[model samples]
Target: MHIQLVRHATLRVGYNGHILLVDPMLSQAGEMPATVNTPNQRPNPGVELPMSVEEVLDGVNAILITHTHMDHLDEAAVRQLPKHVPLFCQPPDREKLKNHGFEQVIVVEDDYEWEGIHFDRTGGRHGTGEIGEKMGPVSGFVLKARDGNEPTLYLTGDTIWCEEVEHALKSHQPDVVVPFAGAAQFLVGDPITMTKEDIVQLAQAAGNSQIFVAHMEVWNHCLLSRSELVEYVRANDLSDRIQIPQNGEKIEYQR
Candidate 1:
C-alpha cells in the first residue's frame, strides 16, 4: 500500500492497484477565507499545494470522503473533480455530493466492496460536548485488499482520542494507522482533532501498528505543527513507530 500526504487532511492512496483520493481541499493558498473563532486569522490553507492540481489528480480512480466540511470537500474540489469518478462517503453526505453534480456518489453505511478493495465505514467524534455536537457526525474508514497482500489501513477521520476512536483501534488493529492530528481549536473549548498526547496514547494501544500523522500546519485553526509533533514523538520515544510525512511525500507499506 502506498499513501501520499497531499496536504493537511487530504491524502492520495494507492492500494491493490487502485488510486484513491481522500478529503480533497483543492483551493489554492489564500483562496479561501480564514477559519472563524480561531487564533490565527490567516487564510484557511496556510500553505500551497506541494504539487500542481493536475499532478495531484493524476491517476486517481476514486475518492473517499469522510465528511463534507469545507476543509475536507470544498467548492474547489466540487468544481474540479471529474463528474463520473466513483465518490464514496457516508450516508449523510450522499445528497450533498449528488447535488454538486457528481455522477457516482456511493454511500458506505457499514461495509462495501468495490473491485478488489473492501471499505468499512467507522464512527468518530469530531470533538466533545456542545462543540462536538455542533460539529455534527463524522466517519472514518478501514480498508483491506481482497487478495491480502496489502496491509490493513485505518484512516481515522477528523477525531480526537474518543471512545469511538479507541473502539476502532481495538476492533481493526490495523497494520497502518493514519490519525488526523493538528489539535485544531476554536476561540473556546478543547481541540477538535487529535493532539500530541492523544497520538501518544493511540500509539501505546496500537500494538505493532505503524502510525502516520496527518492534518497538520495547513489550516489556521490547527495549532499543532509538524516540527512540534516530531519533537514530542522523539521525546516520548516513538519516533520509530510514528512517521510525520511532509506534504506530497509518498510512503509505501508492506504487510
Candidate 2:
C-alpha cells in the first residue's frame, strides 16, 4: 500500500490498483476564508500544496470523504474533482455531494464493498459536550483488501481520544493507522482534534500498528506543529511507532 500526505487531512492512498483521494481541501493557500472562533485568524491553508493542483488530482480514481466540513471537502475540491468519479461518504453527506453536482455519490451506512476493497464505517466524537454535538456526525473508515494482499488501514477522521476511537482501534486492529492530529480547537471548547497526549494514548492502544499523522501546521485553528510532534514522539520513546510525513511525501507498506 502507498500513502501520500497531500496537505492537512488530505491524503492519497494507493491500494489494490486504485488511487483514492481522501478529504481534499484543494484551494490555493489563503484562497479560502479563515476558520471562526480560533486563534491565528489568518486565511486558511497557511501554505500551498506541495505539488500543483493537477498533480494532486492525477491518477485519483475515487474520493472518500469522512465528513463535509470545509476543511475536509472544500468548495475548491468540489470544483476541481471530476464529478463522475466514485465518491464514498457518510449518509449525512450524500445530499450535500449530490447538490454539488457530483454524479456518483455512494453513502456508507455501515460496511460497503467496491472493487474488492472492504470499507467499514466507524464512529467518532469530534469534540465534547455541546461543541461535539454542534460539530455533528463524523466517521472513520477501516479499509482492507478482500484478498488480504494489502495492509489494513484505519483512517480516523476529525476526533479526539474518545470511546469510539478506542473501540475502532480494538475492533479493527489495523496494521496502518492514520489519525488527524493537529490539536485543532475553537475559542470555547477543548481541542476538537487529537492533541499530542491523545496521539500517545492512541499509539498505546493501537498496539504495534504504525501511526501516520498529518493535519498539522496547515490551517489557522491547528495548534500542533511537525517539529513539536516529532519532539514529543522522541521524548516519549515512540519514534519507531509514530510517523510525521511531510506534505506530498509517500510511504509504502508491505503486507
Candidate 3:
C-alpha cells in the first residue's frame, strides 16, 4: 500500500488500484474557521498540497471521513468534490454530509466492506473525563486490503488514550497504525490528545507494529514539534518502530 501524508491528519492511501482519501482538509491556509475554539488562530498547512485538490482527487474512488470537524472535513473539500463521489463516515456525520449534497453517503457502523476492501469501525474518545465529554464522540478506522497479501492498517483519528483504542490495536493486529499525535490542547485546560510520552507507550502497547505519527505543527492548538517528538521517540529507542512523516511525504509498505 502507498500512504501519502497530506498535511495534518489528512492522508491519501493507495492500494489495489484504488485511492482512499481520508479526512481531507483541502482548504488553503487560513481559509477555514478554527474548530478548537482558540483565539487568534490561523490555519497553517506547513506545505503546499502535492497538487490542486482536483489534481490530487482526480481519480479517487472514495472518501473516508472520520468526523465533521472543520479541520478534518473542511467546507472547501465538500464544495470542490464531485457529487457522485461516494462518502463513508461515522453515524453522527451522516446527515451532515447528506445536507451538504453528498448523494452517495454511507454511515459506517461497526464494520463495512467496499468492493474488496474491509473497514472496521471502532469507537473513539476525543478526550478524557470532562474534557472528553466536551470534545464529543469520535471514530477510528481499520482498513484491510482484501487482496489477501497487503498489510492491514489502522487510522486513529483525533482521540485520547482509551480502552477501545487499545482493544483495536490488540484485536486488529494491524501491520501499521497511523495516529494523530500533536499533543493538542487549549488555553483553558490540559491536553486532550496523545503527548510524546503517550506515543511511546502506545508504540510499546502495539508491540512490533509500525507506528506513523502526524497532525503536528499545522495548527496553533497543537504545540508539539516534530523534532522534539523524534528526539523523545529516539531516546526511548522507538526510532525503529515509529515514523514521523513530513508534510507531503509518502510512505509505502507491502506485506
Candidate 4:
C-alpha cells in the first residue's frame, strides 16, 4: 500500500489496484473560511497542497468522508471530484453528500466491501463532553487487503485517545495505523484530535506497526506542528514507530 499525504487530513491511498481519496479538503490556501471558535482565526488550509489538484485527483476510484467538517470536505473538493465517484461516508453525512450532487455516496455503518478490499467502519469520540457532542459524530476505517499480501490499515478520524481507539488497536492489530494528530481545538474546550501525548499512548499499543500521522498545521484549529510532534516523539524515544509526513509526502507499506 502507498499512502500520500496531500495536505492536512487529505490523503491519496493506492491499495490493491485502487486509489481511495480520504478526507480531501483540496482548496488552495485561504480559499475557504476559517474554523469557528478557534484561535489563529486564519483562513482554512494555512498551507497549500503539495501537488496540483489534477494530479491528486488522477486515478482516484473512491473517496472516504470521515466527517463533513470543512477542513475534511471543503467545497473545492466537492466541486472537483466526479459526481459518480464512489463515496464512503459516515451515516450522518450520506445525505449531505448526495445533496452535493454525488451519486454514489455509500453509508458505511459496520463494514462494507468494495471489489476485493474490505472496509470496516470504526467509532470515534470527536471531543469530550458537550464540545464533543456538539462536534457531531465521526468515524474511522479499518481496511484489510483481500489476499492479505498488504498489511491491514486503520485510519483514525478526528478523535482523541480513548477506549474505542484502544479497543480498535487491540482487536484489529493493524500493521499500519493512520492517526489524525493535529491536536485541533476550539476556543471552549480541549483538543478534539490526538495530542502528542495521545500519539505516545497509541504507539505503545501499536505493536510492530508503523504510524503515519496527518491533519497537522494546515488548518488554524490544528495547533501542533510537525517539529513539536517530532520533539515529543524523540523525547519519548519513539522515533522508529512514528512518522509525521510533509505536504505531498508519501508513506508506503507492504507485506
Q: Write the residue-wise lDDT of candidate 4 on 53-171 in tens digits.
A: 99999999999999998889999988899889899998989889999999999989899998788998888899899999998999999999888877899999999999999989998
* TM-score per model over all chains: 0.99, 0.99, 0.94, 0.98
Expressed as tens digits, the lDDT of each residue in 1-255 for candidate 3 is: 888888888888896678988888887876655545653266555445656787667688899998877778777888887778788899888888999998899888888888888889987778777877878778999988787777889988888767878999989998998888888887666667778987898899998899989788776678789999999999999999999998878999888
Give candidate 2 misplaced runs (Cα > 4 Å): none
TM-score of 3: 0.94
Least lDDT summed over 10 consecutive residues: which range in candidate 4?
31-40
Q: Where is model 2 poorest over a 10-residue stretch in terms of lDDT?
A: 31-40
Candidate 1, pairs of clashing residues: none
> What C-alpha lDDT, on a 0 to 100 scale, does residue 150 get in candidate 2?
97
Residue 255 in model 1: lDDT: 89
Give the per-residue lDDT of model 1 (tens digit) for 48-92: 999999988999999999999999998999899888999999999
Native-to-model Cα distance after best TM-score fit, residue 223 in candidate 3, in Å:
0.9
Q: Say which prediction, candidate 3 or candidate 4, comes out ahead on lDDT.
A: 4
lDDT of 4 at 198: 95
Worst lDDT 10-window in candidate 3: 38-47
Q: How many residue pairs clash in each candidate?
A: 0, 0, 0, 0
Candidate 4 residue 10 Cα shift, in angstroms, is 0.3
Report RMSD for candidate 4.
Answer: 0.9
